[model samples]
Target chain A: MKTIKSLHARHHELSDTHHQLEVLNSEIFTRHYLPTFREKLKTSGLLPLKPTGIEVFQMNVGYMCNQTCKHCHVDAGPDRTEVMTKETMKQCLEVIINHTIKSVDITGGAPEMNPDFRWFIEELRKEYSGEIIVRCNLTIILANGKYLDLPDFYKKHNIRVVSSLPFYNADKTDRQRGEGVFAKSIEALKMLNKAGFGKQDTGLILDLVYNPSGAFLPAEQSLLEADFKRELKDHFDIEFNNLLSITNLPISRFLDYLIETDNYEDYMEELVLAYNPKAAEGVMCRNTISVDHAGNLYDCDFNQMLKLQIESKAGTHISEFDLESLNERNIVINQHCFGCTAGAGSGCQGTTT
Target chain B: MQKTYYDPADLKKFGDIAEYGQDLADKFFNWYNDVFKDGALSSREKCLIALAVSHAIQCPYCIDAYTSDSIKRGASEEQMMEAVHVAGAIRGGASLVHGVQMMNKAKKMLM
Candidate 1:
């Protein structure tokens, strides 16, 4: 029932992206005789992974979140103060206006916590009528009075609301997210349902994301989706469009957890053994560019979190965006990428394979 | 050489039995995999059943395998524990049911 602090607030060493990467690339991996991700990729003939194109332009609006989930890769929490300025939003708007990008994914500690979040979305709607995804931590809907109308706002913009509900029940969901997140999430879902977000023929898409609560791969997506649908309908009378099964990549808080629980070596081994070439080919980074709160760009969200900027010749900021050079750049990859390529593969949209 | 009858790692080497008896092992593995596939019972249900049976038989390797398998199949913790209770009840009942014969013998001798 107690709140946990973010790694940044606690001054945990893993908060340093360099330290996290070193832990991921530690000698224990080689000592255990596990193959490096790059070696595995090369064996699969996918070394020097390149971009297919940019289809989704993901923006991390800020790191100021209401809740500090245990497995957060971004380490977002209320204690954090980093937020995106309107100037940065304007720069992103210019890129959106110029590029033929089909989707814009907005994510954050709690993106709605940003002061200018609504303004940015309104501006995006004006110039770009593409698919806009808001990664809403459902609890945020009930976090404050001002956020009470988020569901209606989303429906108005025709936003695709992708929310994380780790499991269908409270015990499992609360264990991962927080003490009472599942209850809040269910309430939030009901409100979204009332707003016709997940209803049939509403033209409003409400997708739920499911990642394992511990150090393990998720069950098959379609099977898990069926279970979520049956259980939610039978128990809570809630409905949603799709369930995206995501594999928890070893990074940030999750990586710290692996070490603390002594599951690091075994987990990394599992991921290595389950590496799928098909999944690697369909990695979201192949067709996505991630923009940080400060307007810096990276190959994908994970890369952005690690500060692995894109290898584009054009430039690494939205103000100097160039699709041609960006498309030609090789994606920045590391051991953590195995999370995306293992088993059926995982991305923001779910399984890649 | 292993000092004990079981090595946790041996579970991974299960397929190696094919080296000694390829035909039998192949048929066994094929049937085993097929048996677990979705049919009369959902694979999730089968996994829970397997978990219970593994506990009844007290196979360490099987207990380890089915525990992870059950989670991977999306079997809830509550359902999994209940399955084990089912196995425990049957095993306990099997022993208790034999007491009827003892009672019948005593009645025959006394009467």
Candidate 2:
């Protein structure tokens, strides 16, 4: 397999968020006669999309990852030096302590890579009793001896571990992720299972995320979940709570891949044509606020990557969080928003509709 | 006239067939939708089968439609290619089977 590098590491043009946004808003959309996501939403009676509430507070702890997965929207990789300091994490924790957010989702290039990851989680556990979700890349658990006990640590903290295992088999999974990722993921899953994360009657929740390895949109989430459950159980004796099938939004590395493969127009048309008003109404951005490593706030992770900060008058960083103002702020939309509204809809948890 | 009979864009206009014959088109599409629903043979399995038949009949539109349909139904690329191979095998076998008749006729004529 060919070695893949983060767009940022290679200093690729798409690594620049503005360049990515420009590509998304370029002439191909007009040539294809596809409506802007806002236009589509307006036609569906959903213009100026506003939040329902801030139910989930997602923090991107860092951009340093062990592996450079091709579809990463963050362009996260081993070479990335940007990581959240304990000070920034404290600011995030302060907001969590003051707010009534239902879930605190910690993500990253690999959230575990942050030196203060455990300290931050330990601190948050002390003051906030709400659900804490750590988006673990399964292989990260096996990436180093220092991280081997991650599954146990998560079990101790009762953190819901959502790991990405792109496919059940090696070939497809490794094709999207790096080679040997599948084997390590399976081993990590076994360790997670041993830690009682995905076992029956164990309150420790372990959910696997699946995004299509190609330009195509993901299949029906329930059907794909059933397939994953059966395949994992039969082949590897692995168990998990649920599967979250995410659509690869055309941004960052994925957007680069789409353009490279000459599938950009077709894939965008697919997303636009499959747009569901129902899905648009239930988009994750409506209830989730994503905070980046530096503590800046955005509607969701995708928007955070695009540098689309919250439009709230109150503030745009975690230190200046205003729940009421943030809730009223209209979500920043572009053509990429169509990815979330396509088919059954996609989000951090899975299908919205 | 267009240079070619098939335009890939025509696939998107398939629903427009209703403009010319609304009742028949409606009936055909409803039945088509029902036929692809999950049954004893899974929808994924049916998609693979349709993809193979698309190859056997050599319908460009059906080929295009079922290729995407197969992927969306979660049939792996390997599984899809195997289905096309099944169609290839059957079509090849049909031609080879007729060789037996030709051989018998030639033998009788020579005798």
Fraction of the real A/B interface contacts present in each candidate?
0.58, 0.83
User: What value of lDDT does candidate 2 attain over all alpha carbons?
Assistant: 0.93
Local accuracy of candidate 2 as per-residue lDDT tens digits, A84-166: 99999999988889989899999999999999999999999988888999999998998889999998899878899999999
Give interface RMSD, every candidate, in order. Answer: 0.7, 0.6
Candidate 1 DockQ category? medium
What is the C-alpha lDDT profile of model 1 across A1-353, one tens digit per residue?
Answer: 35788999899999999999898899977787888988988988888998888899999999998888888888888888999999999999998889888999999989999999999999889878899999999999998899999999998888999999999999999998999999999999999999998899998999999999998899999999998999999999999999999999899889888999998988898998899989988999999999999999999889988888989888889888998999889888999999999999999999998
Candidate 1 local Cα displacement, residue B102, angstroms = 1.7
Query: What's the residue-level lDDT of A49 in candidate 1?
Result: 94
Model 2 chain A scores worst on lDDT over the 10 consecutive residues at A1-10
DockQ comparisons of all candidates to the true complex: 0.75, 0.86
lDDT by residue for model 1 (B3-31), tens: 99999879988999999999999999999
After TM-score superposition, the amount by which residue B101's alpha carbon in candidate 1 deviates from its true location, in angstroms, is 1.8
